[model samples]
Target: MRTGGGSMTTPVHNSPRTLVLSTKTWERELAAELVRLGHSPAKSRYVANKLLKRIVGRAGWQRQAFLVD
Candidate 1:
């Protein structure tokens, strides 16, 4: 799917448990959630961007596995 910064390709093995989100969308949502939890906007964005950068081009399973590690 087309995201703000780039496109995210869903893997072929799409299952109901597999949720794929674009980097931009994840960053925005993460930042928003952080802000809602009382973090500063700048801090929230910084944290979200840093976290999202690691999985920028990763597929859903790879991203999840990476995070789990």
Candidate 2:
């Protein structure tokens, strides 16, 4: 893991359920809500795709992808 300048990057999945799934049964509904509020769902694979980043790719910069206002 990198700290104070290093090559290795810190592991991200340090905890389980750090980002939980959406309670809405319909994924489309949740996505619509996010879009209506002028925000975007990070991705559309899992119940909540906000925590996703491509393998070997940098983690997304936005922390609150699901948040509105």
Candidate 3:
């Protein structure tokens, strides 16, 4: 039950993508948003990270908040 790194490394590289695609709600929402913004659905995860960073920056969430949250 670790959050990241250390002994929690994913054994299969495909696991992360599989997990994301398996989340129906998230995958659908991301695809819809990407279409709305004229970007490819393939870029959803990267775009999501960028958007989250922007939100945290604007809201002044500290570095620990960014990393731990």
Candidate 4:
């Protein structure tokens, strides 16, 4: 998705409070969790992406809050 004229793949500046992981890492961890719970690999990836989207959205909210403070 686009953000401030940049795509989501754009590298963001790192902050102590904003230690963001790579999307692939997030997806891998999420998928592993799902697999442990008996989900198929393909389904796990699909669900992981869905969950990661919401997580990234909330991360933006947190970043806004950080700026406000």
How high is the lDDT of residue 12 in model 4?
36
Model 3 per-residue lDDT tens digits across residues 21-64: 12233334555677678887678767765665576579876423
Please report the TM-score between candidate 4 and the true structure: 0.52
Query: TM-score order of candidates, best first?
Result: 4, 1, 3, 2
Instruction: Give each model's clash number.
Output: 0, 0, 0, 0
Per-residue alpha-carbon lDDT of candidate 4 for residues 15-68, written as tens digits (9 for 90 to 100)? 433433446655767788999899998799999888877876877643221120
Which candidate's lDDT is highest? Answer: 1
In order of lDDT, best first, we have 1, 4, 3, 2
Winner by TM-score between candidate 4 and candidate 1:
4
Residue-level lDDT for 21 in candidate 2:
27
Off by over 4 Å in 4: 1-20, 59-69
The local lDDT score (0 to 100) that residue 6 gets in candidate 1 is 30
Candidate 2 positional error at 30, Å? 0.6
TM-score of 1: 0.49
Q: In model 4, how large is the Cα lDDT of residue 15? A: 41
Cα-based lDDT for every prediction: 0.59, 0.36, 0.47, 0.58
lDDT comparing candidate 4 with the true structure? 0.58
